[model samples]
Target: MGRYQCHLLCRWFFTQSLCSVIVQQRKTIDYSAKQNLLSYATESSLDHLGYMTDTPRLEAQSALTTFEFRLSTVLTGAYTIPAGTQITTGNNVIFQTDVLTEIPPGSLSGTVSGHALVPGVSGNGFLPGQINALITPLPYVASVSNLTESNSGADQEDDDNYAERIQLSPEKLSTAGPEDSYKYWTRTANQNIKDVNVYTPAAGTVEIRCLLKNGDIPSDELLEQIGNVLSATNIRPFTDHVIPKKPDKVDYDISIKYWISTDDKSRATLIQSEVNKALEEYKLWQRSVMGRDINPDEIISRFKNAGAKRLEITSPVFTVISEIQAARERNIECTYEGLEDG
Candidate 1:
């Protein structure tokens, strides 16, 4: 009887020990099944989908700007700044000349296109005077500086963005006459674009309004680049007139006062910090897309989720935004109204 009881106990303990491992294995199998679907796929699975759809992820882009080369004195002969002459901003970020440039005899300087060595947003946003250090020294070359702000640098497409593009790749099979086709091509031009609004206001006219990732109005440079892409003979319909422009911005402000529950007064400071964080997140969600309405109700929900017991939003009443316009936040004021009875 004792030996039978010991065997039974050992069997029970072994089964119990295997339960957790069995559950984990089941979870892994379920997750692998989920990745087979496009919506739930990530990383390598998403990349595989992109490959099947013939839409590869967009790669990081180098920043392009203008660099001017100066001489100590006007020389009798033209001074040539060879292509690939590297320049830096004293920091590690560097730019190279895109083409060979010449300072004509009697001319003090000449400008050439500059391309960033690093390909990503990190190489962007340098002001004109920021890139003055020459990595390659030349005879009589007094200085080298960017003539304009560094622009057109973009990061590689993230998984979510790439997935969206893959979803839209079917539209590319058709001519650019359809709105979705134009949108797919526009997104393919730059990975940083957030939203696209296509409108045919008149016969043969295709007006495209682009909104950047962070509610930044599209720069003229970006608009021109998209325009060039859409203007290609094979891409644009013969009757289509493509005009790329920035979406009109509808400015709005936020002002909110919130109170914490007195029952939870011990966490008042932590809740206040969380409420502030929620407000900024709300602002980002509000402006990141085109045609998103300004809704104080969203603010109220976000604040409440952050442990705000009550909120009084004075600004940002619900406003309808047109498809061709984006909401922009001009100002924000948030006040903590102290603990109150819940």
Candidate 2:
């Protein structure tokens, strides 16, 4: 059965809205004078029916499967470091150098880079200067640092994400044109990919832009993997040229003012906290994918939802941009003026 129909059946059979009628009937029985066998039977039947209806729904839910996204880190060190040498951040996250960086014959050190040995959203999201040191020492390596921010660490895909992909699977599975095939392969390459856009500039030239889960650009390794997958004979058109690129990033600068009730002096702090949280959530929502327009009204609505009696959004004059450009919220600056008279 379809998931939606199964849910409907489960709700109809197990919900209190359905059982309440039987409960009302039981209450009307004149059990004050004598035992009501019919009422007891009705209650028992209701309980059994609820169990029967909910079991299949729960089983179907349990049977559903999901894919997980791989996590990665980028570690950099001096030259002449051997591959497979382990380094770590202070938090116990370990990484190994991928290639050996050899200096000239007499030189003391060289430079190399590596990634996290394990995957999953753990260590830290792409925070600069986060990876500090090595877990152990290597002979030729002098010092280590993060070349680029570590990112793309994600947990297993949740139900909503999985369902959305499942709905699109039919289109992807078809033997459509190169554009369709490009999208199919790119998305399947990494679960952390938030969205993919395909453009055909010429007869056999294809441009694929990818947006990652955290709104950051995809790493070189990720792009390489995507290129490999799309270049496969079965996945790509033999005559087409595929070029993968990252979306252009656009940062937003927002300033706002909120009017708070003067009667509650302590509310000033709460109001500021709420406004800050709302802005953070707005950034996440806005940057989650590419091609989203920046709307000042949406920002104002967030403040209203956060309990601001009155708000004025001062910046971001609502501009329309292309899908290839992604809006980002970095170093958000917010001003919480004093509380206003209610």
Worst 10-residue lDDT window for candidate 1 reads 213-222
Indicate which candidate wins on lDDT: 1
Q: Lowest summed lDDT over 10 consecutive residues: which window, candidate 2?
A: 56-65
Native-vs-model 1 lDDT? 0.87
RMSD of each: 3.2, 14.2
Off by more than 4 A, model 1: 66-85, 97-113, 135-144
Tell me the tens digit of each residue's lDDT in model 2 across 1-342: 999999999888788676888887776665432322313323333334324433110111100011111112223532344566666667777766666555555444344556666655663353544554666565444455665566554555443344334444445544445465567568766667768888777888888888876576787657766788888877676777888887888877877767776775676787778878988888888887788999999988998888677877767769775777788775556776777786
Best model per TM-score: 1
Error of 2 at 169 (Å): 1.8
- Return the TM-score for each candidate structure: 0.84, 0.64
Off by over 4 Å in 2: 1-86, 89-92, 97-113, 123-146, 175-180, 261-271
lDDT of candidates 1 onward, in order: 0.87, 0.62
